[model samples]
Target: MSPVLTYVLLVIVMLIWGLNVVALKLLVEAFAPVTMQAVRIFVAGVSLFIVLYFLKDLRWLNKKEWGYTLLATVFGVVGHHSFLALGLAQTSASNAALILGMLPLTTSVLAMIFLHDRMTWLRLLGICCGFIGVAFVVLQNNGGLGTISTGDLFILLAMASQAFSFILIKKVTATLSAGEMTAVMLLAGSVMLFAFSLWVEPHGLDTFSQGSWWIWLVFFASAIIATALGHVLFNMGINKIGAGQAAVFNNLVPFFALVSAFLFLGEPLLLSQIFGFIFIATGVLLGTGYVDEKLKRANLMVHSQSKPPVSIHDQIEAQGQHKAKSDSV
Candidate 1:
């Protein structure tokens, strides 16, 4: 696919995920967090499995592939969803949105450390901007530093887990297709979540039966569209572009989440959030090499324009004139 198309798809994925934050928050308020997430992920996993099976792409992973897939499942699916659900239960969706916006920086740093990707000064500046932006949003509600809520801490852990999983995903996708890996991870992760929920909240499953029709609708939409399809497209984007570049699109999630939360959950929009969005967007551009790529292209254009290419005839004529002048001298 064209780069533009891939980028558009990534943006759509971010929108879905942004709205999903509100969906999850609503669900958790109505049901147990881990229990809801387990069922949601299970639905997504089953959907993907059915699709893969129909396409004749389903197969067993080899031993090494299984190792990586299981590890990725633990971090990406179980850890991320578990913490995210718990965090949203206690925090506003807007707060969770801004905190999750840190993914690009975290993913880029991990990529640099684990994948040996080069770190440019521009990207470093971007990371700094991202931190400042998140600080603005995170500290806005509380008076200042050291007053962050437990919900925010859980969201941070969730972001960190997802970022680290992106690094592992890069490794796994070298040998397995993104869809296949996602399917296995989601299914395996859902099983872990179910077990955890069983231990902690034995009656959690009863909450599912108590939900209204709209709540069930939200659950299915979140599972199929946001979790299943969203990951498939996102992982495909990672496979096409590098992980860091693809992660920069995550900057859009906070903005989308902010809007969605305001509309759906009656959350108030804050001035600090607008400023935070700007900083985070700018940071993603710089931190993910988007601005750097543009600069490199601009430089190449300037150099080409300043020293235009010479034709073979022009070169020969210049050489001949030079030789005549030298002979005369």
Candidate 2:
């Protein structure tokens, strides 16, 4: 595909992803927290499971991997979704997006602590810049000190859960296909959320509303579109464009989110947002090996349009090297 078209598709994916925030906030008005998550994840999980079953490649995980998978579901699905659902309910979606954007920094810190990942000076600098952006978000949301921060705190919890989950996922990704893992982990989250809602906060059981249709929109959009389709496309994009270009999409999420809020919710962001982007972009550049990879790719690309270069041997070697680099990191 042309560079223009690839970018266009990426932009569309980014927009759809940002809608997840606004959609959750809207659905929160109609459905109770646990109930909403139960339904959303269940639909998503079931849908993905069906697709995986048909594909014939989803594997039953090994015993040890299952343990990490369970932990991942606990944090990745259960804790992350619960905190985010409640957090979005109490706070504006704009705030949630800004806060959720801290995942990279959170994941980086967690990786260093738990996964023995190293942080180079450049990466640490990027992380510091990202934290400064997070500080702006916190200040904006809470209206400064001596104010309530339940919403901000909840988002932080979600970030922490995500950070924890990322480490667990790194451990498990070696053993499972992304689809197999997503199917199991999401179902686990749905089941737990189902039981929680069934017991404690089951108030909205028979709750039906005309506007609740948006909840399904959030479910399908999030589950099917964002989670399933988004991830599948991500894998495909990774193969086609290489991980570096695809990694760029991760940063697009926040930019699209802010723009969506500006258009839909009348959120007028301050100049501080530029700083946030700078931090996030730089952090992404440093953390994902993009900064270095770009220079490498540029040098390789300059080698030839005239020659039918880059045979299958070269491609395999490059991919193997990339995989080894990821494993070492």
Best TM-score among the predictions, by candidate number = 1
lDDT of 1 by residue, 166-243 (tens): 888878777887788889988999999899889878999998788999999999999999988787779779878866
Which stretches in model 2 have alpha-carbon errors above 4 Å?
A: 1-8, 141-148, 209-215, 287-289, 292-329
TM-score of candidate 2 on Cα atoms, chains taken together: 0.81
| Model 1: pairs clashing at backbone N, Cα or C within 3 Å | none
TM-scores for every candidate against the unseen true structure: 0.87, 0.81
Question: How many clashing residue pairs are found in candidate 1?
Answer: 0
Q: How many steric clashes between backbone atoms does each model show? A: 0, 0
How many residue pairs in model 2 have overlapping backbones? 0
- Model 1, which residues run further than 4 Å from truth? 1-10, 142-146, 235-248, 304-307, 314-329
lDDT of 2 by residue, 73-185 (tens): 99988898889887887776766787787776678778788878766766677677677676666666434434436887798798789778978988988768767787888
